[model samples]
Target: MKSYLAAAVQMTSKPDLEENLATASDLVELAVRRGAAFVTLPENFSFLGQETEKVKQASEIAHKSEKFLKTMAQRYQITIVGGGFPIPVGDGKVSNTALMIGKNGEELARYEKVHLFDVNLPDGNTYQESETVKAGVSLPPISISPELGKIGLSVCYDVRFPELYRQLSKQGAEVLLIPAAFTAYTGKDHWQVLLKARAIENTAYVIAPAQTGNHYARRTSHGHAMIIDPWGLILSDAGEDPGLALAEINPSRLEQVRRQMPVLNHRVFG
Candidate 1:
C-alpha cells in the first residue's frame, strides 16, 4: 500500500457552468482510465468568465448547495479535487474555495484561498481577486487516503507562501495539492521553480493542475500541469495542453528524504 496513482487535470475553462462541468467530467473519466486513484482539477475548473461580477453571480453555497461537484465525484468513483469554485458568502462577497470529495461523493474538506492574487504584472495585466472574492479564515488540510497520506489543499496564489506548506508538512501532510489558474505572465517565470522549491524544502510531493492557454477575451493562462516527487524530481508533466498527467506516489520516499535531510526537525524561528 505504499504506492498510489495520482493525476492533475488541466483545462481552459469558459464562462458557462454546464459546459465546464461536462469538460471536467470527461477529464476525470480520462484520469480514471489512466489508473489514477486521486485526481485534481485546475482552479476555476468550473468557470472562467470575462468579468469578476459574473463569477459572483455563478457562485453557489457548499452545504447541500452545489450538486454539480457531488455528482461528478460519485460518478467518477475517484477522489476528485474540484479545484476552486466561487461560493457565495453574504454581502456581495464570495469565497474562492476548493472542495475535496471522497470516492463516495462525501465532502472531505474545503479550503478557501487565504492569499488572493492581487498584483499588476509588467504586461499591463492586473488582477484584483479581493474585489469580488472574500478571503477564508481557517486553514485545514484534507486526507486523501491512508496510503497516499494527508494532503494539504491550497489555491493558485497560496503557492508563494512557504510557511503554509511548512505548517502542512509538520502536521503530517505528505502531499500538497495546488490547483491553479495562473496567468501566463507569472507562470512562465515562477511556476515550475516555485513548485519544485516547495517539494524540496518541505520534503513533500506536490501535484499542481493548471489552466493553460487562453480563456475568454484578453485572458491567457500558463498551463503545465505537473506532479513532482518529494526529492524534487518531476515525475510527470502535461506540458501546455488540455490533458492529464499521472504519477505513482511513493509515501516511503517522504520518510526517506526527511531522514536524510532532517530539515523539518532542525527548524527554529527566532
Candidate 2:
C-alpha cells in the first residue's frame, strides 16, 4: 500500500511572468493539498508570448521566476519540477531547461533540452527552436531518493525521439517527465499514443504536464496533461484545461511490470 503521490499541472500561460507564476503556484498548492509529494508544472510556465520575449525572459528568470519555484518547493515541503523555461547560455542564445528542486529548496538537477523543434506543420505554422535555443549535449538520467525515483528529464519536442527515452531507461529511469507546449494540431493527433508507447516500452511511469489553450493569437496548445502507468494505463488526465492531474507512483507495481515483460533486458539494438 506504500505509494508516492504525484501531480502534473497544466496551464495556459500568458506573456506576463508574474501572472504565470502566480497561477502556477496556486495549482501547485492545490496539488499538495491533494496529497502530492512531487509536483510538475508545464513548459513555459513562467511566460509564453513571442520568441523575442522568451529570449528576454531567459536572462532574468534565474533571479525572478526560478526563485519563485525554489521558495514554493520549500514552503510546500515537496519536490517540484520547474517545468521548462529558457535560460541564457551566452552567444545570444538560450537553452530550454528543466529544473528539479528538493523538499528542502535545494536545486537537485538541471536538464537542457537536446532536440530543438525545427518543423513546418500542416497548419502553416513553423518553429525553429535552434535559432534562439542551444541544444544540450549530455543524456544522463537524473535520479533522487524516496521523494522521486530515477527520473528521465525531457522537454516538449523530445517526446518524438524514442532513443532518448531508451537511453534513459537503460540508465535506470523509473519515472519520465515530459513538460511540453505541444501545438494543438500535433498533440491532438499524437500525444497520447507517444506517451503510452514510452511507458509501455520502458516499463516506467510517464508524467506529462502541458500548456493548454491559446497563449497569443497564433500559438495554441493541445493540453491533455496525463499520468500513465507502466502498462500504458492513464491514471489521471487534465483535459484541455488549466488544472492538475494526480496519480500514485507505486514502486512495486513498476517492478512487477518489469518482471513480467523485461523489455529492457531483451533489447538487442542500441
Candidate 3:
C-alpha cells in the first residue's frame, strides 16, 4: 500500500502580482502543514489580469517566476508543481508554462501549454489566447521522484483533449496534473466530468488545482479544485472558494484498478 500525500491549491488570483503570489504562498503553507509532499498551484497563481497586463509582467523563462519556484521548493522541502504563468518568447507573445521543482530546489520538468483557448462562450465572452500566447509543440512526461510516480503535465484548455492524456499514459504517466483557471460558464458544466473521465479511462490519479471566484469584471472562475483517484472517486474537493484539497496517491491502488479493468492493456488503437 505505497502512498504519498498530495495537495491541490485553489485561488481567486487578482491583477496584482505580489498580492496573488502572497495568496498562493499562504495556500501552499496550508497544504504543507497538512502533510502534502507534492503540492500544486492553480493556473496563473502569481498573476491573472488582462492580456496586456500579463504581457507587461511576463519574464523570460529563466527569471523571476522560476526563481520564485526554486525558493519555494527549497524552503518547503517538498515537490511543487507550479501552475501556468506567462513566459516571454519575444514578438509580444508569451508561453503559458508549468514547472515542477524538486525538494532540493532543482528543476524537474516543464510543460508549455499546447492548446490555446480561442473560444466564444455562450455567456458572450470571447478569448483569443493565441493572440498573445504561443502554443507548445509537445507534452511533458515528467517524474519528480521515483517514489512519487511519473506525471503527465497539462494546463487548463488541455484537459479537453484526451489524446494528450493518452499519450502521457502511454509514456508511463501514473499521475496527471491539470492546473487550470477554467471559466465559470464551462467549468460548471464540464470540469468534474472531464476530470473523472480522464482518471477512469487512464486508471491514474488526476490532481487539478484551479482558480476560483472573480478576478476581474469580465472574468470569473468555477473552483471546486479536487483530487480524484484511479477509481474515479473524489478523494478531496476544494469547493467553490480559495482553499486546498488534500489526498493520498496510492500507487498500489492504482495498480489494483489497472489490473482489475486492464483497459490500458486492451487498447486496440493509439
Candidate with top lDDT is: 3
Backbone clashes for every candidate come to 0, 0, 0
Error of 3 at 255 (Å): 1.0
Off by over 4 Å in 1: 60-65
lDDT of 3 by residue, 1-270 (tens): 248899999999998887877787888889999999999998888888899988887873337667778888899998998889999999998999999999899888998999999999999999999999999997776674676888889999999999999999998889999999999999999999999999999999999999999999889999999999999999999999799999999988998999999999999997
Candidate 2 whole-model C-alpha lDDT, 0 to 1: 0.89
RMSD of each: 1.9, 1.3, 1.4
Give the local distance difference test score of model 3. Answer: 0.90
Give all TM-scores, in the order shown. Answer: 0.94, 0.97, 0.97
C-alpha positional error of residue 106 in candidate 2 after TM-score superposition, expressed in Å: 1.0
Question: Per-residue alpha-carbon lDDT of model 2 for 99-123, expressed as tens digits?
Answer: 9888898988888889999999999
TM-score of decoy 1 = 0.94
Q: After superposing candidate 3, which stretches have Cα over 4 Å from the reference?
A: 60-62
